[model samples]
Target: MIVWVCYSIVTLIILQFCILLIRIDFYWKNHRATSVELPFVSVLVAARNEERDLVDLLLSLENIDYPADKIEFLFADDQSSDRTAQLLGQWCEHSANRSFISIDSSQAALYNENGKANALGILAEEAKGDYYFFTDADCVVNREWIREGVGSFSGNTGLLIGITQVKAERMLGRFQEIDWWLTLGFVKVATDLHIHTTGLGNNMVISKEAYVKSGGFKSIPFCLTEDLEISRAIQKKGFGIAHQVSSGMLLKTKPEASLTSLMSQRKRWMHGMMTLPLYWKLGLGLQFGYFMGIIGLFIFMPKIGVVLALVKMALQGLFLHRFAHRAGERGSWLYLLFFDFYSSISTLLTILYYFWPSKTNWKSRIYP
Candidate 1:
């Protein structure tokens, strides 16, 4: 029984990996950018207590290669108690195209949402653009970010996801950088296949029409990860979501301070996915199965487990290395070796927290 079960799981894993490999070719088939008239874009940043990294993001936006007249920056400060508002104020004063909104806890209550979603909702309403580019305040985007990202938008395209990279100097930070590349790589492939995939809010662009049609953040049900919910909502309306994997369009973010904080972040993501549609639920199950299958094989069928584990790791490592190099992430292959063990442990722990259901901390704001 154990042998059969492990064998079946390994077979499934291989099948999925094979599909991902084929979809990767989808990236190389088209090396040219689509030519479309550039539309005005509203860059949305919803921040709370992000004083430390906000200025870096502001400066990066100022450096984008896109025309300044065609772009506007909207920052929603969710009742920040620090220098976040002050910095935003200073940036907006010198720039005619930049604006900021202050979101209070009372407004979140009135909107029937939490901090981030509430802030995003307000920004969406106040925005004046054909495209809405959502990003976190702690991230620094590339100069061609808008140029390349917006270039991908043809009429039917509702969403475009830019790849994420981590700027980390510490060992733990390096682990996070590798882990995110692996995770985002899977997201990219799944997206290419038109399968259900959650997007990183820090680097996503959506058409304003799709945002309104999918029931803008205000109409969409409140969730910890608003981007995932909005993505699903947009897809359900038959709008196409695309990916931009070019290194030049990458968005860089800070790493978590500690393992504990990292776990907390994972728990939040797990919780958010748990509320997704049925197909998304199956996708999450596949991730869980991939991790547990190797463990079960090692425990019940040692000889087969060692051989299969090595095979699986090699396949995943090579694929991730290629993707990392293409996406301009360095030292990713070394960290891929540690990703399997780290992911298994982290996924199990995060699932536990997801089920327990308690208030979580994000940007110093506690959410239930």
Candidate 2:
């Protein structure tokens, strides 16, 4: 009993220390770029059946604060069966700064399984920007999105990684928003301190030169976690990568409409983590500690574990409560307690998926 207690205490202390280290690093973000020359930026949007949101994204691009001539938008249609292609053509007919580009897999000759990467590679080859920025078609970009991202390309960074927040409209949506904020915020903070951060493909900016130097997306054409793989690849090249917390370049994505959709998404995300290298995987230690702490409490002292779990959840709520308040998300904390339970169950289900290697259905397409 004493050994278990000691182990739990040590784990909690270590996690708290790690959190503090990240907070210190974030507070003292010293890698700001001083260059004033805003390079030409190519905004790459990869879409599949995004007809519902494509128009909004294109319109948002038109409204971005960056110089229209300096910023070029490239839409890579992943052979969408919906009105996505037609809408792109309509948008291109009127928009001078943007073009609707198609992925000719027959020419680039990509395997069916590596469709997205192949499309991105073809687009990257044709992109004429000094910097390449990637975001999904379903995301609504803030007016300063491109400006803020390009501004981060200072003397030190080869890749400029930015933050993303979910647009929560419902109870489930609010839960997802809080979930992403707390979890991703901690991960980004930790990565900044430990130098093991992975980039989210949505709202990521990299110099064209660095992209070529790092071997580009072709380096991992078959990777499920292409964004993370690319970020790690950039790190392997000894270039600096930093996350911009102040710019507020939020990429708005809708939360899963159903629990089934949410589970599938979580499974896919967890399975993708398997492809990461060992050092990156070590980032999961905090998550493991949290899980073990809960389990140990329950098994060793059911009554105590129940109380501690509730207290830990309350702490998590406080963290997220602060984050939501800062991010302008209101009434999100109402479901905070429920999301805490859902997150634990989701983690367990995700672990099961990682070990099982079963087929997953996403966006009406089945992937193995």
Best prediction by TM-score: 1
Error of 1 at 259 (Å): 2.2
> How does candidate 1 fare on TM-score?
0.93
Indicate the residue-level lDDT of 89 in model 2.
87
Q: Across residues 1-368, which tens digit of lDDT does each residue of candidate 2 receive? A: 75386347535735564554446444645334565577788988777888987887888777888777798888888778899889898887886777867765463436325566666776787789999989888788888777677766666577877667888667777778777887666655655675666778777888887888888787764656677777777777877788765445566777888877887887777766777668656656555557666677677678777776676666666655554444445435568778867676767766776567677776566777
| Candidate 2 residue pairs in backbone clash | 33-154
Candidate 1 lDDT by residue in tens digits, 122-163: 889889999999899989989888877777776587988888
Residue 160 deviation, candidate 2, in Å?
Answer: 1.5
- Give every collision pair in model 1: none
Q: lDDT (0-100) at residue 14 of candidate 2?
A: 50
